[model samples]
Target: MRWINILLGLAVAGILGFYGIRELLADPVYFLELFLGGLVRGSIYALIALGYTMVYGIIQLINFAHGEIYMIGAMTALIVASVLGLWGWHSAVIAILAVVFAVVYSCAYGFTVEKIAYKPLRTAPRLSALISAIGMSLFLQNYVMLAQTPEFQPFESLIPDFAFWEPYAHIITSVELAIIITTVVVMILLGMLIKFTKIGKAMRATAQDKIMSSLVGINVNNVISTTFVVGSATAAIGGVLIACHVGQINFFIGFLAGLKAFIAAVLGGIGSVPGAVLGSLVLGISESFFTGYFWSEYEDVFAFTILVIILIFRPSGILGKHETQKV
Candidate 1:
């Protein structure tokens, strides 16, 4: 089965390469533009998917409320930016402050949610936790709607266009460049944290076995809460970047984005960090190419179709290992 999956993957790659080469030959500029656009989209998806994958790695729960955490991040940024704008603060300063507040608030919300909704249900049935997650999601959505109007709010781009980047501006804007760079940096830092830090080591051990980890000196609860905080921080960054890119946001924005990121996580292998990033890039690039070459209206159709195909062919995902339990 593993060999079959490999061969199938190779075949799919070959076919994609053939068409990609042909498209590039037909229109080099357009092809590169679409590819870059896909990278930007993929970067955003990867940020959110990282949060999904990490939390799942630690607790094996989907944490549906994560999307709301992301929404709160964006909303928090909007509010900060708006107030700063009114005060005539520097654009760079406003951007930095907004991001800081977003991350802080989102992290707080994530920790609180884990304690209130998930921690208490730790030993309960998985379905109970999942239902609680859904309820929490709905609660956050309505709470945000009531707190901040349901109407779409305009968001100004905080990323500044560099004068030196004028030549390449046509290929990709400053915002897109920032998103890609930020994702790369964040990924590298996360990799280092997981590989070197003490908390990172604890997270790894806990993921392997909760009881054994607890028996050994590691604080399982602390590790779990830390996981939520880290995931929320990454999702908050994604939220701010995406809000700046889209120029407008509403209370419901996170629902669709979160759903797409979840699909990306599953496509990449939900519990694997690298798998999440790879899957997001693949999904984003595929969506970009499909929308550019085929039908823009059917972009969502294409994404979900890809997810269905992946699910049918590789239930464990591209990088996920199939578990075998001893009877």
Candidate 2:
């Protein structure tokens, strides 16, 4: 009965979506612009969603602090750029260094966060670990507030002002182009790394069964730490690109982005990488179209509404595999 309802709902959605796509494409210029915007945003969401999915897949923990890790990354970039600007550094140099510094600091933060906040709770009750994650999130947010001031910091754009076929609905900006390219490249490289590398094998093994991986002489703890590092690194890159695109940052910026990315992870199937990517793109495109056509203030409402529908119909997500437990 449930499957029937889901199939019916999906069919209706597909029909509506087909028409929507046609309407959007009727104006190729506008459609291209909106699509590029959504792709950029979705790329960022997918990067962050991978972290959520990976952490949950391995340990079944949400690591709510993940968003703050992204915040730290953006904050690091902002600081680095500001400092370089004061030194009269070239825009290119400033941009490159800012991204580098952001990634480094985020990696360090990620490693420390996992060790201090998550590692201790590995043997504790599930609820306890969850509470600890929330507590750490608050602690990181407040810590940044105190350290960096609770004001919005302006991020200088490193992307040169360049556009392609601007008369046709501002086809795409250089920043957006770079973001899309970088995201796709990184995802591909990551996929290849996971598929072929030794560390990747260990990660896969650990994800499958930590106890068994450890029994077979795999360093489970190292794999877990590496997972956090990789996730944080991707988030850091996203922070750099997003901040460059948006031109401002604040202590609280990560909260909403984190929430949306988590939603994307859940929507894509909590443990599937490809699912995360698909979910992020869907959520991003939907939000972009909604904001453009409907009132901007309610764009978020539309996104959440979609989430509700997906949860009601396909809680496992578009590509996520459902698991069955046997007693």
Candidate 3:
């Protein structure tokens, strides 16, 4: 099975490369545009997928409500920006404040959700926790809908264009460039945090063995809550960036975004951070090409098809380890 998967993966890669090179030669500009567009999309997905991957890595539980948290972040930012804009604040300042508020609110919500919906169920069956996550997702969705209108809200782009980059603006907008750069910086900082910080060390230990970590004097609860907080922060940034790019947002936006990010996480091996980013980029680029060359309406169909293929051939994900369980 492993050999078969390897062969199939190689074949798919070769086919894609052949077609990609041909398309690049045929229309370099169009191809580059699609590639950049996909990169922007993948950056947003990577932000949200980080949260999904982190939580799953530590607890082995899928937090469905995570999407709601992302929505809340965007919604919060929209509200903040609207209020500030009415006061005639500068767009850059408004953006910074809005993002700060979004991160704070989203982190609060993430931490609260863990305590309220997941912590008590930590020792319970995985199904119970999963169902709780779903319920929380629904609750947050309706809560926001009632609090804010169900109608789509306009989100002004906070990213300012650089005068020096005018020549290349047609290929990638300032907003898209900002999103990509921000995702990269965040990923780098996150890598450092996970690799060097005391809390990061604690998180790694807990993910490896919760009981042993606790026995070793690490505060397991704090580590779990911290993970939730950090994940929420990244998702919030993604929400804001995407809203800025799309120019409109509704209560339901996070659902599709979160679902796609989850698929990316699974694709890259859910528990691995690097894997999540790689998976998101691959998914984003492939989707871009599919929509550009084929039917755009079936993009979701294509995403799921990839998911199914990965599940069948590489369930551990591209970067995930194959673990063996002993009876």
TM-score per model over all chains: 0.96, 0.94, 0.98
Instruction: Give the winner by lDDT: 1 or 3.
Output: 3
Please say which candidate is ahead in TM-score: 1 or 3: 3
lDDT of each model, Cα atoms only? 0.94, 0.87, 0.95
lDDT of 1 at 129: 96
Q: Which lDDT tens digits does candidate 1 get at residues 1-327?
A: 889978998998999899999999999999999999999999999999988999998898999999999999999999999999999999999999999999999999999999999999999998999999999999999999998999999999889889999999999999999999999999999999998999999999998889999999999999999999999999999999999999999999889889889889999988999999999998999999999999999988888898899888887787988766656
Residue-by-residue lDDT tens digits, candidate 3, 6-107: 898899889989999999999999999999999998999999999999999999999999998999999999999999999999988998999999999999
List residue ranges in candidate 3 displaced over 4 A. none
- Choose the strongest candidate by lDDT: 3
**Which candidate number would show the highest TM-score if scored against the true structure?**
3
lDDT string, candidate 2, 201-236, tens digits: 998899888999999999999999999998899899
Backbone clashes for every candidate come to: 0, 0, 0
